[model samples]
Target: MPEALAILQKYWQHDTFRSLQKEIIDSVLSGHDTFALMPTGGGKSICFQVPALMNEGICLVVSPLVALMKDQVANLQNRGIKGIALTGGIKQDEIIDLLDNCQYGNYKFLYVSPERLQSDWILDRIKNLSINLITIDEAHCVSQWGHDFRPAYLKISELKKHFPKIPFLALTATATPRVKEDIITELGMHNPVQFEKSFARKNIAYMVFEVEDKLFKIEQILKKNPQPSIIYVRNRKSCLEISSQLQTLGFKATFYHGGLTSREKDKNMQLWMEEKAQVIVATNAFGMGIDKPNVKTVIHIQLPENIENYYQEAGRSGRNGEKAFAVLLTSPSDSIQAESQFINVLPDKAFLMSMYNKLCNYLQIAYGEGINEEFTFNLNHFCHKYGFPTLKTYNAIQFLDGQGIITFLKEFSEKITLQFLIPSKEVIRYTSLNPNDEEIILTILRTYPGIYEIQAAFNLPLIAKKSHHSEAEILAVLHKLNEKGIIDYHSKNNDAVLIFNEIREDERTINKVSKHLIRQNELKKEQLQSVLNYVAEKNTCKSKMILNYFGEKATTNCGICSYCITQAKPKKDFSTLSNKIMALLQNEDLSSREIQNKTKNTADDVIFVLQQLLEDNFLIIQNNNKYTLKT
Candidate 1:
């Protein structure tokens, strides 16, 4: 076996490489700068991982998300391959220890966020490590034209100055032609070898439907497919409501959203992964770094903000090379709603300046004195106090974070600690009286061995699972204990944290990056328009449209899409369609849906014929909104 194949079999337990995997690996092994443009499920990680394993020293990976970094590190460690991630919320001393492990403890991978590279201390430490290769995940972020542009990514090329001889590998799931050019130029790749897998999934059918009742359509689709599936919603409320509704309708369903505690998210995800639940309703936070091969369908009930996000989400299905469906359900009001949610909330230069000033005031930071200061931020309370709109303010903060003016970490959970105040015998007696709390109290005591001697933080979800209770119930018991002076409990909830990277110059800070901000807003508008056009388009094949958007020209129509199916049917003359519609109404008054069902014609053709009939005075609508022959 090839050395790469041997490494893959040992670590990943796979025999063969997917399409373009071997070629990309070979390019990297040959010591050339490589760029791999694979789709969401194309096994991009293996392209760099296998070759790095074959090399002598550790591979340094720079990624954008903390969760993604931690997940990759955990997976590597599970395979008995040592790895470390320098993610957010780590203290200086802990970072030193992790970096030491990377340098001397025989670690194979070191994953860090792009922002971490800016620290001189970290760069100096990294300079001393025996680096073999540098991998940049989500490489499109280096491009300003990319859907998710980050200024931190632009600084990644600085690593070349330190590791000039080490080969660089850049990987991304989706990128446009412009973004591709930008990545190459910005990273300063030295004559890189580029490998791009076609963005078309032949096994997955892309279907779009315009319907009046989205829930009814969703039910019909789920009932027909009846396999493991995912339904993507736009908010936490929708995740809960849809999952509950599906459960009530006799389907094993669960939900996930950003608001869910870590334990809740893990429990719900486990149910879906183990196939105990038939469907998972979730917001966009659910699918990153997740690969489930048997997913037969992925349904989006609303229009996605952009085609890049939509394609990546829809591409999550049919990974097993089996027939699957990517269904998009849109109502008449969806276009307006999508525009309001995505486009209108984009922050312009004026809004950014105002938001920055308001944020400093909210955090009580004085001008030119608040550099390097961090504070807990509650977005809802801040917005309420200042009478500012929530969504726009959130977008402005995100823009500032991307610009490197500040660091905004959302959904930041604070530490929860507890310690026993009474003696062990007294606690046992109290628990015996409250038998309901006995299991949880004992489980916590067992899990944290030092709880009796000192305050210790515990995993609420793990205790809930061990004691057979919900997190809320566990919290209630703890509260009761604390109120009775049996234990000292402390907990805090901060929605986000803001770290000011620069001193407060307010308007001057905004002025430095105003041009880039305006350009980014324009890019967002253009991306939104592309999604709208994709939804409104009916003549072209959906798969071909996506390919064309990504700079690939696909000539053949995918026969499985809704547009192709409609085109493949035998075309009926206008008179034939009109006659069929008229015949359906002659039996009794019928709605458009009934006419389309009886006539077995496409909805567009039926609607066109119905309009002609109505205009010709051959059909009349009654008070019930049903059509009939003119009297």
Candidate 2:
């Protein structure tokens, strides 16, 4: 503990640990398998990072989120600690080199994707490393019952057979009792020390507004709250549209989604993080790896698919432990749309196999030939070419990915690659002949090494700055170089990466995986229903509802959420107000406020009774907006 604290102070500049962080770190340092159930922004990374600093060997971290892994690796490097993240879109030799560094470079941390565990070459290299600990981030993905289940995570248990003595620490921000048990069993944890922090974020005020105009409600909330906010929508088009609308409303806003290019994603996210953009209207892809501590509000324009997703996204607010608001603006149409988008249209077994075949065909993979091959997948193009519905096709692809038959990733930042076809000397000679392109060639050489040996990723802006050329000019030079056979270039970014784990198969082989899809659909329906129930529930505190859903017992109401606030407000005796309103209408027509003043009732009570009377047809409002009793 003393050593861990010293390292933390040195690296993080913190004097003490957050809730349960010290305990979890101590458990790992004591060489015991540990499972930590922390809410979002609970500092789960610190639990393993501190212990890894105390240990003698590298800590192998298996994660499902590429952005998070990269962010953490960058953070560790910033702290002058030796760490590396081996993600997708890199050459095999690059991974080998990185693993070699871990083996002999005395690196303290190694972040790896779960899918990479299936490669025998990777496993062989990992077995040779001096691994003292294994940390699994997003451990909930190991269970089929998890909202973001990934079958690649199941292969992590195989490591237990190889590194039996090394302790395993599994961490997730969201998990239920079932997922918890499944994680423990599937990971082959032995007498694991379980640390579950309270899922309740008392600092957050949960509010659900059933409003007809979601945009107007969002506007009202933004106007009331301070800046540094996130507005989550369901689709990419809405992300852009809402952001544009917010800009028109005079708020500095940006948009983000899975479909955006890497450059756009980075720029918009950086703008929001640096406080240059006060609000970011985005899809669910916006929250991961983002640690803006002062986010005051997280408004959901549409219902999330499940409670887990909703809770995670909503929990992104108030992370700084300050008071914040999580407002859900819903319309009557939103419920039906959310259900159809998430649950009712889930592809069945037949559709699953058919989609699988179509995907294989789209990639043009012959039977038993395309194992471990990855392709840049465009879902819309595939759907258009094959006459498949976009929603069902997406769900079907998700199911196949969960079955380990393939790997689908939406985040790939390895665009703008260049590889030299000739030697550097030859390239220099050609650049001398074409002096106009000399600066770009030299800039590429200086910015990224190993371009001659392999395709190297480069930033266009950095290269342009160094070369004193515009991005278009740099691209033109790169294209010229490629045409001249001096270098090979591939640009025009692809957003998705699809890897086929096995070759194309017949219906029988596909059916084996599709059978599980049925059960998966059922589980999804249950999860959707849970979300619907949470939104429809009015008697329970939103915090309590969330806590109870995660199997935590809340002893008292939060006293600040929308439900609690509504309950605490004295329930006005509307009976007297209703009688007064009816009597007043019988005598003469009056406006709502006039009726309230004449009856000596509260304004809210008067409005409630008036609305009820109007709904019941006992009173009618004229063009002048005065209520009168029906004839």
The prediction achieving the highest TM-score against the true structure is 1
Model 1 CA deviation exceeding 4 Å by range: 412-470, 478-491, 572-631
Please give me the total number of clashing residue pairs in predicted model 2.
Answer: 0
Candidate 1 per-residue lDDT, tens place, 338-445, comes to 889988998888888888898898899998978768888899999999888999998999888887788887764756899999999998998889888898999998
Candidate 2 structure, TM-score to reference: 0.83
Q: What is the lDDT of residue 439 in candidate 2?
A: 83
Clashing pairs in 1: none
Q: Candidate 1, TM-score vs. the true structure?
A: 0.89
Q: Highest lDDT among the candidates is held by which one? A: 1
lDDT scores for all predictions?
A: 0.89, 0.86
lDDT of 2 by residue, 269-293 (tens): 9999999998999998888778888
